[model samples]
Target: MANQLGIYGEQQAAQYFLSRGGIILGRNVRYNCGEIDLIVQMGGEVVFVEVKTRSSWDFGAAESVTPRKFTRMKRAAAAWLEGQPYRSVRFDVWVYVVDKGAVEHYEGIDGGAS
Candidate 1:
């Protein structure tokens, strides 16, 4: 049930991105380092999205994105980028509170200047 909700959250996040003019390139992309929830393209830039979902906000959904997870996401994104055409890239976090079916999107979560 939890896994199903997570998948449903991912689907919601995908629609959210798409509604804002993003083109989803992949979903649940796995690499040696980790898995990326969604890979998207908006305008001319590539976006690596991380989706965090929770049944309730008792504990914030985005709060679960630890530093370790961020590092792994970066590594996975780097690995996924290898051999691909050069393009500007971004990292985004999509938080879904499933109980409310609300999505809060954080764009360019990686503050490091690209």
Candidate 2:
């Protein structure tokens, strides 16, 4: 159930990005460090998305992406880049609320230098 919700959320998020003029660079890309749920290029920036989905927020879905997770995400993004050049990079959280059928985007999320 959770996996299905995640998939749906990713799809929704992808569509959301597409509608807003962002180009989809990758999806579900994985590495030894971690997985990048979505990669988008908007203007001169590459945006790395961490997707979190939940049937409800009782478990605090927005708070689930931990500092350790950010470390892994950064590593995975670097691996994915592989010398690809971008003017800048940003980390974002795309939160999907299943029961509400809503999406929340948190841009420029940080875990320090990780």
Residue 30 displacement in candidate 1 (angstroms): 0.8
Q: Which stretches of candidate 1 lie over 4 Å from their true place?
A: 111-114
Candidate 2, 1-114: lDDT as tens digits: 778988988998898889999999999999988889999998889999988888876656668788988889999999998879776999999888888887778899998322
Model 2 scores what on Cα lDDT?
0.87
Collision pairs in model 1: none
How well does each candidate superpose onto the true structure, as a TM-score?
Answer: 0.91, 0.92
Error of 1 at 76 (Å): 0.8
Give lDDT: candidate 1, residue 81. 90
